[model samples]
Target: MDYIDRAEATRRILAAKERAGLSFEELAQVVGAHEVWVASALLGQNTMSSEQAAAAGKALALDEATVAALSRDAARGSLPAAVPTDPLIYRFHEIVQVYGTTLKAVIEEKFGSGIMSAIDFSMDIDRVDDPRGDRVKVTLNGKFLPYRTW
Candidate 1:
């Protein structure tokens, strides 16, 4: 599908999800995948398998085109700007900006010169209760890929 088509399909999927009163976690159960991955697939960041697409489509009451779009290869990271303007999204960008070098240094100290693999990554988000306030816990797990010697 074209960019506009994909955007519209995403809107339909989100609307149908809201209309059905289903959480991404619930939809993940129906699609038999992780909630984050399912959410990413639905938002056009990742491609879903035909079976997953069908399951999600059935659960969300999505049309054929939207379902098909879900299974298509996505042009990921379709952000409008390099720095996200949305507050929540911007927080993540801010975090990376602040901690990018520190993380790299620390990780290299432990794992040697290498980078984390986004292709082989998994993430989990949780709510942690605290006396002061609830805390958001985000876990990012990725394989460590060491730089190869030429």
Candidate 2:
């Protein structure tokens, strides 16, 4: 089947999602994947399996072209600018800018010269009840890959 571009596919999926009034979590349940992974696949940052694509298509009532697009390998990293313009995204960038070194130092101290593997990562977002206020909790879990030496 001829597939549409990832951006167009994303647009179509988003439109269908809005029409269906489905949250990413709901769609993820239908797709049998984590919400973040499903969302990333729908947004063109990651590829979905054929089964997942079909499930997501059914959930969102998406077209064949969009469904096919979802299974294609993605180019990844769609940030349009060096600094993100979106407030929420920018805040994440800000956090990295501020705490990147600290995190690196801590991680290195704990795990030696290694880096977390985004390729083998899973993330979860949840709400934590707090007396002061409800807090957004994001957990990122990834395998640690120590740098190889010649």
Candidate 3:
């Protein structure tokens, strides 16, 4: 298995993280990035600089090769299948299926012929206690890029 498979390196890092008993927050502090970003990078959803990778490796006690793998540019959005089979991931797919058009329409109306950028985005997740149950509060902040005319 290779890093390109998106499992080998990640698995090693996860093992080290477990052994260290370090939370994502603590690891993020060492990596000098936001927790969500650090998590995403580790999950192969984003790329990390050499320094960031070295820091992460040092903090996680990963091998140099794994650290080098972490620094490589990833082929992003490589899913196992077209539609995910995982229940939680499937729910997100369902959300997009049900509301994707609605979201596009509303975003166009508000942002004006523009689209939100995942490249230049920030996300935050929080836990909110509710009378019914604990709620997951997620905030996605993205820069809006308007369509350009020739």
Candidate 4:
């Protein structure tokens, strides 16, 4: 509850899971946590809030006392020591951060009023086997709908 070293708390919480004989993936599945988060928490690379720690504790079948201890541990933490090395998918995000305004203006200019329907959207990924190396292909499909008239 007091000033907890974020890094230290992460270690203790993760140790709790490990002592339960659960692998990172297994513990994540049990606690409904993302495997990445579980891994980070254990490695003292990621911090959590009281709520998150409590939830994780409950998921790991930790006792009430342990849950309380973790809840206190959750706060007073920062991000993972190392940033994830993987590249972020930027195309989809462009719709939110970059082209969002421009696209809105363009759509308003072309159509009376409309939006792309996520409900009708679809995605497909192809895993191709190659003698040189594997290849991943991705495709997206979606329907566009105009806003209702007055």
Best by lDDT: 2
lDDT head-to-head 1 vs 2, winner: 2
What RMSD, rounded to one decimal, does every model reach? Answer: 1.9, 1.1, 2.4, 9.0
Q: Return the number of clashes found in candidate 3.
A: 0
User: Would you estimate the TM-scores of all the predictions?
Assistant: 0.94, 0.95, 0.90, 0.36
Off by over 4 Å in 1: 1-4
Pairs that collide in candidate 2 are none
- The residue-level lDDT of candidate 1 at 22 comes to 99
lDDT of 1 by residue, 8-78 (tens): 77899999999999999999999999999999999888889999999999999987889998988876776
Give the TM-score ranking, best first.
Answer: 2, 1, 3, 4
Q: Model 2: per-residue lDDT, tens digit, 1-150?
A: 665899999999999999999999999899998999889999999999999999999888887999999999896888976799899999999999999999999999999999999999999999999999999999999999999999
Least accurate 10 contiguous residues by lDDT in model 3: 1-10
Scored by TM-score, the top model is: 2
Predicted candidate 3 versus true structure: per-residue lDDT over 1-150, tens digit per residue: 234444677878888989999988998999999999998888777788999999998998888778887877775774676889989889888998999999999999998998899888999999999999999888989999999999
Candidate 1, poorest ten consecutive residues by summed lDDT: 1-10
Alpha carbon lDDT of each predicted model = 0.91, 0.92, 0.86, 0.60
Candidate 4: residue pairs that collide: 45-80
Model 4 has an lDDT value of: 0.60
